[model samples]
Target: MTAACLMSTYQPLALSFNKGLGTRLWDQDGREYLDAVAGVAVTNVGHSHPKIVAAISEQAGLLLHTSNLYSIDWQRQLAQKLTRLAGMDRAFFNNSGAEANETALKIARLHGWKKGIEQPLVVVMENAFHGRTLGTLSASDGPAVRLGFNKLPGDFVKVPFGDLNALEHVRKAHGSRIVAVLMEPIQGESGVQLAPSGYLKAVRDLCKRWGWLLMLDEIQTGIGRTGQWFAFQHEGIVPDVMTLAKGLGNGIPIGACLARGKAADLFTPGSHGSTFGGNPLACRVACTVLEIIEEQHLRENAREQGERLLTRLRMELADDPNVLAIRGQGLMIGIELKQPIRDLTMIAAREHGLLINVTRGQTIRLLPPLTIDEREVEMIVRGITRILKTA
Candidate 1:
């Protein structure tokens, strides 16, 4: 009906949308779409969740921002909850995934400097997506995202993701200079690539052996997206430092860097801080998001629905030779194709009343809300299967 007016940096389809509920999004034309993107994995509790809306409305009327100088009760409460859930001792909140990751990089640098290492290196994995900030950009290995930015920070040791042998080999060679091993439980922006079985445990043990901090970037996979509060929980392993954003605040601009043990003590008062981090309103909303996730049993819903969705895709698309692989956990899933299918994103949206994303060129990533139900799961699988078959 009308041309898009948004900036060029983002490529929103010509469909104008309005409201969303549960797993469905409605456009201005009253067309409904089964949403599997979940605002890039931010709205884990689902759009317009009653509790989250109430928290935002209530907190907005109360105190919003007062800097970090005074004691913000809500911020402290959220920090406590996140740290407890993460099995970490301390937390520093920011406003986005990049900020959270920026804090983690700072910690690694500080840890390295403390030990008299001039050039403290961080071990990162290929296809990792940390964030867009300068330091986090250096940490990310995605070619398209990293393109045109020359002379990126040189301290990152790039290793193939899920390659435990490569990790061990690099650890032995770079142990003394390495400060941290930063990775994502699942490579989100690179197409929901999950590490191999027992891979996280092996990495954790390797980090311990080398006395390097294990920092997990759970921005897209956290907040029950992976059938647990955090993806690493599936492996029953813990990281020394972790970065969180995306669904943490249910769309309220909040990120956090959680640390445990010695890593927890690395950040002093002036060593790191954020102006809008842990603000009253954002923290209050994040707390409510966590509450609703637990109260509504979204984790269980994600596991059950995700299993059904994954099974249906494999079974339905099994005979289709174009579909290469189906891999991922919980709501974070990816369907790889034999060839690049980036164009299929728009095709799915326009033709099938669905919204899905193509990442790493050839893989379709599904990040449905944790609150998605069985019916919606079936719709998503059916819609995508149709698109793949026709394409």
Candidate 2:
């Protein structure tokens, strides 16, 4: 932190972790902390997982990068796994969630051209977080993120997340010009908000009726973070386009944009590309991450542990006057406070030896590893209760 050479885009926590296991981390002071944040949901199978470590070690000895001009076998395997899980026809790998979304938005524009619309507008929900890039930022719901960046990418229309009537209104007014609808299955940045029940199905029907593509952002909720492989699976309907990252590579930094049917054939060889994308190392590691998630049954663990955590939190904090709301699904969880307790992050670390995060100022976000055990769930419940009670 004292190094003046690095730019200060992030205000990192005071303590640095030296080692990690399943749900535990040891800091520089040798203080053990329960990592409920789980590296912000990147380590789905857990830190230093034996399989993940071995995969990394083996692939590093092999080929790391050979450029996209040639074919990558691991990349094809990773895409095959993702497409099977996502129920999409094809996938394109990128380095991060932002790039995944950027790919999705670009595909939307191309689909618009096929629909005979020159300036196609994609409808996005409010209070959603896509990414930091300008194209994704323009589609994002946060005004603060897009504040300094002027001239955002054009043809993006905003709509209330859970409002079906407002979407209908937009369709009524600008029916021909709108080419796609982009949304998160669950709004992660806006305090773990769930779209109203039947909202996604309704939107799917609407898109089918009007010939507009349905693009779902599953970067945070994909890869078994939710009980299902992807959050959209809960609704039992497949989307025209879907983007994934985060847990996909278990911290190796890989993302994929998937498409089905007509959307699948939209991109040609020269139309879109990435140099470091779909490299052997990242893809092999991602394939191992997926295998471990299934082998360990972390998806079921996410369901049971997440349910227990939420229920216990509600039971513990229900009587507390400061708690406003508690809502979540699977491992993606949140509890909103009546007041802004921004400093609670430090307090949780200092007092309870727990790593957690606060989003939207007042909402405490819990994105623990999907492999959390019953005992660790109890620990998280207690740690969060202490923070909420004292704050």
Candidate 3:
């Protein structure tokens, strides 16, 4: 009930919510707030969705978990669905995005080792975020992620994101040592930075020519958040390895590492495993989440609402001097300010009764639930516009 018991990792806002519905949250005092952050994009179908709640309640009553030693029917069904949607051949389950990315890194190392290459290196992008674990942290960029943790694995080669020439330089310099190139399709944590047009396709082609596995960390851009089953589909390209989490279970906490071609078969029986991964409850909930997204046509809604939000924000803030850029895809939108506004998130919550987030200091990142309607989108645009104009 108090912050004293928890670790000092996160400095959460002073407010706390007692309940949540589709795109809305209520505090202990019964004050309502529009949730644009969506639990940092984990609640794509919206908070406490009926179907998701039903699935969770039913699965809890039936079975919660069984370790990876046994065969899980739900896991098999979920895996089949996800791989089919992703165009990947196989999947390995984990508990979080960090674990999923760690699995991909391991697969890349194994792929290199099989070909008799020693000290395999994975090419990563600068300002890209994978996860907080040591291996994933090494693969990620930015000093905040790498600070305090000394002696990180030095096998990752960091290059500027969206720069093909830099990638080429890495290939030329570390061609033999490099086993894979890992990056986010859209850099989410350091603000919603999208890949340059045609960049993903070019990276896929380069990987094909250089014989390096192309790994995409789609933790934030996957599921129905990007108006597609996965962000890679937007570019019409497929990577050898892909990592997913955040929205897969719609807040149930499940992560997956999907692979195709040679990358699929690299993980042998004992090579990698998780105790709680792919359990019945998580898998069943994920299956329901996927079904809800498909049945309700949430992806289409995401695109439409996203475009509506983007256009309205641009129109409203077009003449504002403080606003620099407005960019987004689907429900993942960002409004970059000319300078960081201190305590912007707190002001949005306390004064405007809206939930939001700021990343890379200057970008107001919005990851509203995919289930939001027109009225909610309008509310978001209005709240954001007011905050920016006053700031």
lDDT of 2 by residue, 1-391 (tens): 5358878677777788989998889998899999989888898888899988999998899889998999899999999998998889999999999999999998999998887898899999989899998888988877667888888877888899999899889989897999999999999899999888889999999999988999999999999998989988899999999998899998898989999999999998799999888899999999998898888888898999999999999999989998999999999998988888767899999999999988888899999999889999999999998887777
Q: Of the pair 1 and 2, which is ahead by TM-score?
A: 2
* Per-residue lDDT of model 1, residues 206-230, tens digit only: 8898888999999988999989999
Counted clashes in each candidate structure: 0, 0, 0
Which of candidates 1 and 3 is the stronger one according to TM-score?
3
Candidate 2 minimal-lDDT segment of 10 residues: 1-10
- Model 2 clash number: 0
TM-score of each: 0.96, 0.98, 0.98
Quantify all predictions' global Cα lDDT against the true fold: 0.89, 0.91, 0.92
Instruction: Identify the superior model by lDDT, candidate 2 or candidate 3.
Output: 3
Off by over 4 Å in 2: none
**lDDT for predicted candidate 1 compared with the true structure:** 0.89
Least accurate stretch of 10 residues (summed lDDT) in model 1?
A: 1-10
For residues 1-391, what per-residue lDDT tens digits would candidate 3 score against the true structure? 3389898888788889999999899999999999999999999999999999999999899988879888999999999999999999999989999999999999999999998999899999999899999898888878876889989878988999999999889878977998999999999998899989999999999999998999999899999898998998998999999999999998889999999999999988898999999999999999999999999999999999999999999999999999989998999999989988999999999989999999988999999999999998889888998888887
